[model samples]
Target: MENRIDFVNWLDPDMSIQILTCLDDLSDLLRVTCVSRCWRQYVIANGLCRQLCLRMFPQLSKVVHVVEQRYGTKDPAEVGSSNFMEWQNLEREHRAYAFLARGCTTFPIRDLISEPICASSTDNYPEESIDNTLEPRDVVAQRASYWSSKGNSNPAEPEMLLYKLMGDLCVITEVSIQPFEAYFQWGLPIYSAKAVRFRMGHPKSPVDVPLGESYKDYENKFIWTYTSQEFPMAQENRLQTFKLPEPVLCIGGFLLIELLGRVQRQDMDGLFYIWFAPSSLFNCSFLVFMVNCCELFQDQCASTLIEYFVILAIIFSHNVYVTDQL
Candidate 1:
């Protein structure tokens, strides 16, 4: 009589797969791998970790393949059988997917704007400056603050805001914007655009893009990695969120905001204006996870250096004593 229980043997393979697919947490999947040798093999061979990651974030499907970057590793050619090679491939997938899932689920949230680059046009130099948008509050120094575009007789003339992110690489997920309401004006119109679009990219050259200046083909300076769909903006004096279709891997760290159409007209000037506070970029950086590991490596290198120097000192001392005695 069989004393040990094996669920995989008792149930159909499809049933077993269905049961495992229900697991959503990476920790739980990891625990499943630890149950027994057979269990570990089953999980890895089926590529469950990769499947779980793809299920949670379909955006990751863009990753065509996973290539290991491990150094000080020998080529698998000398160590191989067909079965062993297959198992190695499965093992690599298991580790890669697990790390991807962890990063996607656990990155920290923070505002990623380094500085406001420029606005297409400014209505007032000091009072309605683009820099004021960086201040979170609408009021600064006891005065209502906002960045306003130059009024245009053509309502269709779009406006733009450009900003530099905190780092050279970023995974941007969302953006926050607030339309400026001119409380001081009659009817208290909120100067919100009809629609908004976002683009993420890097500069064409290292130092070609000039500050406080722009050219006719200003976009030529950037190589955009991601461009979001145009989302309708509400005409309200409140913070609005525009979440990306997928988390964008922004290589060049520059962000562009396009305000598509003008909604409100200034009664005194009979022209349309786009007014907004400085927007915030929400992102997670891969650099954060690797910092601790880099610190650990640095500490180990320091210890090794100390040990190496002590060994050299002892050898030198022994040689000097022998020479003097002779």
Candidate 2:
């Protein structure tokens, strides 16, 4: 017996809902909404869908697409450069969304991003200091002054402490009181030296008299600061906090761009690229795919229909709990 069927009527509410849920699980939570009005409403009405959208869709989208663009293998059958460019565009969007989804911290996140390598314990010294014999003779004999042409001929002459090899000039400033570690980077070593001048602290009007020498004898010197190419400290400036007022989307994109620059500079490793690339690519690919698909079927799918589907896709398949899935 042949089965009599009406295609439109066959799509019962329950069946439609089940199909959407399945789409949410399989393809994309956001994509499923594009299927139909009922699917859109069902995903929207469910709180689970919202959470999934937050956790999975935006963030994961950033990861997948970013990586696929720059490092994706070329395929003859694929669109190649065009898709790669498209991926880059989406990568920017994904990054912005991801950054917003997870609040980006400005406190030198890059430092934590890289793996720590063990080196000499320059900060903490052991109670039992190594004998002079353990240290290199050159370092041990180091004096407090820059070497001058006047030379070691006069024992009265002070020797330079930190020498920039290949140059005769040496610096000796009165900044730091005790021996302190200088944060050095890019071949420039920060010296913890005090300035030679002081600021006046006079309560005028002939009220406060002079206390021995005027306050002109000393100035507050800034030292003991580490210099990183990532975060540079301006002279005379102390630590301060700044707020980011950008939308979560814009900030996320900025962070991604920052990450890319660092990666290109070789400051970060391949693992970071691996971690971020996937999510970025995914977002780009999915968004672009949806946009293209909608445009292609515009004759049948109205713009509102496309939007509804996109929103539904975000809802049903969205997985908020899916963290670091890539």
Candidate 3:
């Protein structure tokens, strides 16, 4: 009877889907699917299961740029349909609104600065293109021309955003207080952020401050000697905040490109790092589901494909639990 009860519990697909959909725990559902072929088939065939999966697959727009940076492709043509364009704009506005909800009155300074620099008013291509009179190459050139006009006007390279900000010593000092991956390695890919810190200026007094002194004692001694108006307490704190080597920032851009280059290499597997915290992981999963639902405003994909991938990703994440139990 105990074995019978265990068999019934293990065989339950409705219960698996319920936990996945209700708890929003894809990892657990995924684990169950990996347990046997039956659960996988049931998930694939169920309408509600498909709907849930479709709702989770589109939360990848931010990382889309990173993928392109790694792979050297523009946004896919399929993702640029009129409906998808509207959806993309809507998502941006919605994100802005959500940030506003959390008291972020301003968006990232980079976005604000880049807008007019890279702005274009062009929408979907001409009806003639849709009607197939223009050759594919012509259509590509026309689209490129539209974007080129906007980007060429005072033409901003993306790297310029970082380089211009790099020498601004005052701003670098401010970033030191925050340990976010951005402040330490602005141009590096997100995963290479471990132990990175911000640095700004040289150590004072023409000799190294020994590592033996407590931070407070070092500060007190520096404050007394560097009394010159040029390097006051505030300036000392700013300079002291420099933790990571400044030279790393110089190599950051090239390192990013190199990391992308090695991504497909087998030996490079050791270099990949998982930096997502539990909260961030949960939030991303939720966003994927939300984007899937809100995607109706843009290029539409069949709900079935969305369902397929989301469920699969969720199942794969269950390896975490299986490993933990062992």
Q: Which candidate comes out best when scored by lDDT? A: 1
Clashing pairs in 3: 30-315, 55-289, 56-288, 56-289, 83-298, 83-299, 84-298, 84-299
- What are the per-residue Cα lDDT tens digits for candidate 3 across 167-286? 111111012211112123334333221222221121223334332222333332221100001111121111112222111211001000000111111123323221111111111000
How would the candidate models be sorted by TM-score, starting from the highest?
Answer: 1, 3, 2
Could you tell me the TM-score of candidate 3?
Answer: 0.20
Candidate 2 regions off by >4 Å? Answer: 1-19, 24-27, 54-326
Q: Evaluate model 1: give its lDDT.
A: 0.69
Per-residue lDDT of model 2, residues 61-90, tens digit only: 323221211122233236558766554444
C-alpha RMSD in Å of predicted model 3 compared with the true structure: 25.2
Worst 10 residues of 1 by lDDT: 308-317
Candidate 1 residue spans exceeding 4 A from truth: 1-15, 71-86, 115-131, 136-145, 160-174, 183-188, 197-232, 242-258, 278-326
Extract clashing residue pairs from model 1: 133-278
Q: Choose the strongest candidate by TM-score.
A: 1
What is the lDDT for 79 in model 3?
66
CA lDDT of each candidate? 0.69, 0.23, 0.22
Q: After superposition, how far is residue 251 of candidate 2 from its true place, in Å?
A: 14
Provide the RMSD of all predictions against the true structure, rounded to 1 decimal.
12.3, 23.4, 25.2
The residue-by-residue lDDT of candidate 1 on 155-218, one tens digit each, is 8898887888765545677787888889998999999999999887666665445454432347
Rank the models by lDDT, top first. 1, 2, 3
> How far off is residue 47 in model 2, in Å?
3.7
